[model samples]
Target: MEWGRCSEKELKDLEAIVGAENLSTGESALGLVSRDESYYTPKIPPQVVVMPASAEEISAILKIANPRRIPVTARGAGTSIEGNPVPLFGGIVVDMQRFDSIIEIRPEDFITVVEAGVGYKDLNKALGRHGLFFPPDPGAAATIGGMIGNNASGVRTIKYGATKDYVLRMTVVLANGKIMEIGSLATKSSSGYDLARLFVGSEGTLGIVTQATLRLAGIPAHHSAAVATFPTLQAAAQAVFDIMRWGFSPTALEVLTADLVQMLNRDRGLGLREEHTLFLEFQGASEIALEEELGAVQDLCQEAGALSFQPGLGIDERNKLWEARYETYESIKHTHPGADPFVADVAVPISRYPEILEYTAEIIRDHGVTGYPFGHAGDGNLHVVFMGDASDEEEWGRIVRANEAIVSRALELGGTCTGEHGVGIGKQPFMEREHGASLGLMREIKSLLDPQGILNPGKVFP
Candidate 1:
């Protein structure tokens, strides 16, 4: 389907709805919203960038765009690495930054009402006051809306969950200027179709979320962190699988490769052992309970052939370690000055975690490319960042082939093309192979919700 262009009259209509100051067609403004943190580039630049402060304003803008068939791409903090928010068709890019507002925090109910543009760290800071937090740590300065768009989850997901688990309700603006609320404020519901969940990871192809009510988790009274080194990546992965299989509940379980550990040591002055390592964090209600659990974990790691197991890190040391872990992507990028990273995010069953890691290492070695493998190992998620020069088609081709091989292996192991990152341009090709016949139903749902297909035109579908 051909998308309508943003004409001068349509631009005037948008400015009238959002005011001239809230709208911009400037070169810098268009450039800013044209792409996200992904390696993909936009096919064309957006004609205008509009920052709407309310659902009503967004409704008005969508009203004008829907009839005209102008593509509307909703953007949050622009932190997604999958090109989830790129304005590929280039019509009106709706910037949601101005909608930042923490409306309400009901500590008793373990719920919080917030506007879509609020940052993840900002909300956590406020929630910390009440001994509660929204526990889908995506490790980026991402907006709540963007997190919901991708259904993001990080290391903590092994114990807590992803953004989709915490989202109770959302106020969304559908195509053609319809403002509707989805989901329930109650804890559980056997209600109709789960429209709230449908919109959570839709990547704004179905609707634009304006506000949300999220479920929160309480802060644990006691927490402990440890690092376990292994002789090989497979050994570390086996330990992770065994720990989870034996009913060990860790708050965060991350695995870093030897090369990645070396990079972290050089970049962050960590001075860590440059070997395959596992960073583990456990939280509980009492110190004694945590200590007991750590002791068991150490025994399990040793049984799995751990080279060394160091447990019981202090608060400051744990914080510094996590800070460096969160900066893994940046550290890799910094190490390779002018190279672009092609990240492959995949997940499989816990039993197959070790096999996938070994397969990934082999694929990287066979392709003759620099790859960093790491991720939330407890949940069987693996992220391999392949660094290369984008302009060098030959070298980048090898990286692409290696990524495809890894994803194919994950799918064969009963996994998914993307564990947390959404199906933006990067993983579109694997949608059919991953979903099979169900992909057609998804496209039908997309068409049903957006007949004109003006919302995030080139996304989700292949």
Candidate 2:
């Protein structure tokens, strides 16, 4: 779709609504907000960025933008790997950082009301005071609203479930400038329509999530962690399945390959090599509960032919170990100096995970390039880092070929092109291959919610 230029009238009107200081058309500023951490290269800069301080202001901006046919992409921490923040058509970027506020906490209800810009670290910090916690922790300090928007689930998803599971209510600003309240504070409800779920993973294509009421969990009194080592990648993956099948539930279940382990060992002095690792975290109210869980896990690892299994670090040690998991992007980039990498999120059934990983490894090996394979193994989501070789065009071509091979294998095994990362522009072309006719339904839904094609245009449905 050809992008229409921003009219003088629209710019002036937007400037009036957001004030001159909050609006910017400068090249550098627009370029910064025009794209995110996705692989898609920067294209045309957004016409301007408008930082609205409140949901009311957002509604006003949307009301004006809809009539003028201006594209408005909502941006959080700019950590989206699917190019969701990239403005394919020159439009307005709504900076949501100013909306950061932890509005209220209901300890009895186990729900917290927060604005769209409240970061995960801050939310947990506040919740900690009340002996509660939010579990939908996507890496990168993603905002609560953003997590709900993308239905993000992190390492703890093995037990806590995804963002959609914890969301109880929300205040969403739709594309047509309408403020719609979906769901209720009640834990269970048979509402007229499940609109909350629609916007949860809509990726801002449906509406701008301005506020949300998310469920929280009581802080466990006792917790235990373990780092299990295996002789091979397959062994580690098998250990995850075996441990899960034995009725043990850990708050977090992660699988790291030898390459990633070596990287961690060298960069962070983890000394975890010669074995694929499973970093497990168990939460309970008593030492016995934690010990029993870990004990079961240790036996399961042994049954799965683990090279060795040991208890996780103390509180301080566990925090340091998990910190490395959050720095995966930087670690992978460091692996191949001078090479830019695009990460892909692919998830398949647990039974097919080993095959998928083997296929991905073969593709990367055939290309004669290095890539990191790691993700939440308990959920079967894998991250394949595709490092681009700047010096050789032929090598770059091989990397693209490898990506296609990996994605195709995932689709064949009932996996998706994306697991948690939304399909921004990076995976648009594969929508047909992944969803086939369902792509039409998605487009139809987009049209129904945003007929003018103004809200996050050129995303999801291609």
Candidate 3:
């Protein structure tokens, strides 16, 4: 598809809609929105960047761009690991930063209305006062809009679920500059199509979310954490499968390779055991219940050949432990300075968790690549960050091959190419393999919603 260049008249019209201050054709602004946290290089910079403060402003901007076939990519905090927010066609990028506002918090109703650009941490900090919080952690300080676009989830997803589960309603600005609101506040709906959910993981390909009403979860009355070390990565992975199989529900269950643990220790002063480890957290209403659950988990880990089981951490220690876990990606990056990360995010059935972990290890070993394999093990999600200098074609070729091998194995094991990270550019090759004929239906929906193909052009479809 040929994309139109933003002429001076179009630029002035957009500026008039959002004011000169909110719109920019500056090189720095275009550069900032041109790329995300992904390793993908920015090939073409956007022609203009506009920070639309309200839904109406976004609608007006879309109205101007949609008819002209100018690509409009919505950007939030720009923290996506995949290039989900990258403007590949070099048109107009709608920066959602100005939409950061917590509209309302109805604690009694267990819901919060917020603009798309509110930071995840900032929203939770405000919710903590009311004994409530949003569950999809996603690690980074990502904006609500970005999370919705990618359906982002993190360690907490094992129990609470992803961003899609929490999203109830959203005010979206469609490609034709029409303001559309989808979803209901009711807990259960027997109503028509679930359009709200349709847009949740669309990655701004369908529409741009300006505001969202999310379902809030109450804070647990009690919390407990434990650390279990195993002699092998497979052992820890097996324990994760067993814990899930035997009906042990953990708030967060993470498995880390020894190399990753060492990196965390060196980078964050964590001082954790430099062995394959499983980090587990349980939330309950009573201390006795938590103790019983921890004891059962210990037995499962022991049966899987655990070297040590340390349970019952204090609040301070628990906070510190999770903080370290949340910074795993950063820790890996810091360990290999000047190297880019090619992260493989895949998920399989719980029973196939151990097999995938073992297979990933073999691929890394055979390729002789520096890879840190770790992830939300309880949910059968595996992440391996292959670090290498992108400029070195031979070395990076090995990394690419290793990634492909792992993803192919995951597909063979009834898994997906990406568990959390959306398909921006990196995983586009696997979309057909993973989705099969259903992918054709997805394309149909995209075409129906965005006939002009102006919304987030050159993404999702292979």
Candidate 4:
């Protein structure tokens, strides 16, 4: 689609709706909207970027977009690892940054309503005062709407579950300017279709999420952190399985391989080196309960070949420990200056996690690609990042082969291509390999909701 073909009158009206200062067709602003955090960059740019403030305003913009057959890509913080916000098909980029506001905070009911643009960090800051938390932490300070769109979860997910589990309801603006509400603020529902879930990981292909009501949990009375080292990655994974089998749940259970530990130690110099480590954090009603959970987890780790169990440093030190995990992309890029750290976010059944890790190791060795493995083990998701010098074609080929092998192994082990990250353009190609005929039904749903294919085109379906 050509930007020149878009109606000037519509642009003028949109500028009026959101002040002229908010509307931008400038080169610098357009470049920012052209690509997301995806590995590959496309040259596409939106015809105009519109930052609307309310659901009504979004509906009005959609009325303009639908009538003119203009593609509309709804974007939040643009922190998606899969290029979910990139305007692949030139059209209007509905920048949702202006809609950031905490609509309501019901501490009594343990829920909150927030606008789509509210960042996760800011939300946590606000919730901290009420002694509550919204536990879907996706590393980056991603927007609530974007988190919901991607069904994002993080290490904290082992206890609280993913974004979809806490999302009570959402107000969405459809492609054709129809506004609808899905789900409710109540705790449980047996009402009907559960349309809210359908849009949770829709990646903006169906409708634009304007607002969300999220469930919050009261802060635990006590919290503790621990780090256990194992002889092998398999042992670390086995420790996680044992913890689950014993029916004890830690708030966070993460597996960091020796490679990842070395990367962190080399890059950040925190002296964190262990063959395989389980970074565990426990939260409970009392210090005694937290201690019991810690002891039980320590025992399981020992049974799984733990070389040593170390208590995590104080709060600040513990923060430093987890920071390395979150800044993995930066760490990899630093270690291999020109390498592209393309992430393969895959999950396996708990029983098959060890096999998947073994297969990943084989692929890494066979292809000679640098692969870093670490993720939320309790949830069975591992982020395998393939890095190779950008200028080396031979190395790039190895990276591709390694990624293919990892995804194939994951699917073979009754796992998913993604656990938290949605199937944006990066994983769209594997939809058929993963979902088979169900991919066809997904397209039908997309068509039924968005006939014009104006809402985030060139995504979810290859």
Candidate 5:
């Protein structure tokens, strides 16, 4: 649907609601707002951008836009790779950057209250003082609102869970300019509806999150990191399956391919083994207990054909050891300049993890595409990145085919097309396949919440 663009009068009214300096229609600002990290091409810049500092301001802006049937997309730092924040239809883009403020940090309650624009790094800094943290580390630049919107999670998810699990309550502005407060700070609730969860991963289509109350975890007293090398990806995946089934929980368990390791060493000068490696971390009651757990994991790895086990016990060592996993995307881009990169993640049952990896490897090999396969193995989620020259349209098609094959197989194995990253436009094809008839119910809910369909149009669905 073609959304109506904001006219001079509408833009002026938006400026009135959030000040002239807080609103922009400039080409440069629009250009920056038009694109995200997604592969979807030729940015569709918004007609205007409004930076609201509060939910009331957002409601005012929406009140103006809703009547005119203008598309309003909520965005934070625009770090979403799924094109979640990109304005596909030109209209008003709600920039939530000014809404950043740590409203409260209740150490005793193990909850934090922050505005939508609060970034993960800043939240972590505040939580550090209290020796607590929001465990779901989605990405470096993700905001709390963005994380909650996408229900983002990462390696830390092995033990804690996703952004959805930590989101206790949120202040949301519905599509029709009505504000609604959902959820409670209570440890558990038998309330009317778990409304907070409905919007957690809605990708901003349902509502604009203005504030969030997140559940935090205490910093482990004893922590250690390790990397166990294996001759093959199959063996590493096997070890991961065994470790998870053995009732041992890892703070983070990552699987990196040999090629990715080589690229990391060449680009970052981290001399990691150029073989499939299982990166593991332990956190527990005491140093002695942590060591014992590590030993048990070491035994499992050895049984699964681990080549060597290396430990990173100190602070610096632990950080550096995990750096290899963190530097993956940059390494891929650096090693092959001008290659268009497409990253996709899928999660499966722990038992099927190894077969899926092996099958994905075959698909990449058959297509002759440079694929980087890595991710949180403990959670049975894997991310594979395919890179090829931008000018090579045929290779792009090949990559798309690879994505289709992997996602389809993942579904067949009772897995999701996206493990952490929310479905923006890229994964829309598999939505029906994954959710089946439930897709209709989801659409109904979206319609009920956003009757005019003005909020974040052209997302989470075709």
Candidate 6:
């Protein structure tokens, strides 16, 4: 859809609503919020940036922009790996950082009311005082609002579940500037329409979330971590299944290939084994029980033909070992500066996890494409970074083909096109292939909520 340009009258009116101090039409601000942390191309700058301080202001802005058919893409921290908050139509980018506030913490109720701009780290820091934590740490400085947008799940997702699971309520401003306070605090509600779930992963296409009430989990008293290296990637993936089937609930179960390990070692020189490894951690209240849990997981790793397994005896040691898992993305980029990184992620059934990884490896090897493979094996979410030759068109084509083949195979294995990263512009082509005719239903819902098609245009569907 061709979008209407922001006229002088419209810009002046927006400035009046948000005040001149909170809005900008400058090129620098437009470019900064143009794209997220993804390789999705052609950064389209918005006409204006609005920094609304409250939900009321957001409602008013939406009320004006929606009628004017101005695209308003809600942005939070700009940490998305999928161009989720990128403005595709060059409309208005609503900067949500000013709304940062941990409004209230109901410790006794195990729920916290926070503005959409509040960071998960700060919320957890405040919750730590009450011995509680917000689960679904997406391992980035992603705001609670963005996490809700993608329904983000991180390493701990093996145990804690995703963002949609923790969201109890939300104050969402629809496209027409109507504020709908959806969801309830009650643990179980057989109420009409689970509206909160609809918006949780809507990617701000349905409505703009201004505030959220998140469920909190208590901080476990005792926790232990272990790192084990396997001879092959399949062995590491299978170990996750074996450990899980043994009735063990590990907090985080990650799988990293030898290439990633080598990159991590060369970049950080931590002396880690350059082999396919599984970074596993267990959490509980009892120190002895946690130790036993780690030992049990280690035993399973040994049974899965692990070369060596090391269970950290202290917290610092465990964290140091686990650091390898977090640094793989940066390590790949730093190690291969000229290679354009294409980090594609997909999730399949647990039993099919190893099958897909092996399949992906075969495709990569056949195409002669270099990439780093890693994932949260505990939940069958595999993330691979294809470092395509930056200036080589032929090699870039191979990388693109490999990505397509990988997503296709994941869908064939009863998985999704995206495991955590939402269907931003990069993943649009695969929506119809993944969702089939249901893609029409999604469009219908999009049209119903945003009849003018102004909210996050040219996303989720082709």
Which candidate number has the best lDDT? Answer: 1
lDDT of 4 at 378: 92
> What does candidate 6's lDDT look like per residue over 45-69, in tens digits?
5889999888788888887787778
The root-mean-square deviation over C-alpha atoms between each candidate and the true structure, in angstroms, is 0.8, 1.7, 1.0, 1.7, 1.2, 1.4
Which is better, 4 or 6, measured by lDDT? Answer: 6
User: lDDT tens digits, residues 103-214, model 3?
Assistant: 9999999999999999989999999999999999999889999999999999999999999999999999999989998999986787999999999889999999999999
lDDT of each: 0.93, 0.83, 0.92, 0.85, 0.88, 0.87
The TM-score, computed over Cα atoms with residue i paired to residue i, of candidate 4 is 0.96
lDDT of 5: 0.88
- In candidate 5, the residue pairs with backbone N, CA or C atoms under 3 Å apart (3 or more residues apart, or in different chains) clash, namely none
Candidates' TM-scores?
0.99, 0.96, 0.98, 0.96, 0.98, 0.97
In model 4, which regions exceed 4 Å deviation? Answer: 1-5, 390-392
lDDT per residue for candidate 2 within 307-398, as digits (tens), equals 88779469987888888888767877877788878786888988777788777778788878777788888888888777886457787778
Candidate 5: misplaced stretches above 4 Å?
41-44
Error of 3 at 334 (Å): 1.2
- What are the per-residue Cα lDDT tens digits for candidate 4 across 104-205? 999999999999999988998999999998999998879998998899999898888999899999999999999998899898999989999999999999
Tens digit per residue, CA lDDT, model 5, 356-444 = 99999999999888899998899989899888865678888898899899999999999998998889988899999999999999999
lDDT of 4: 0.85
Q: Candidate order by TM-score, highest to lowest?
A: 1, 3, 5, 6, 4, 2
Question: Which wins on lDDT, candidate 3 or candidate 6?
Answer: 3
Distance from true location, Cα of 355 in model 2, Å: 1.5
Question: Of 1 and 6, which scores higher on TM-score?
Answer: 1
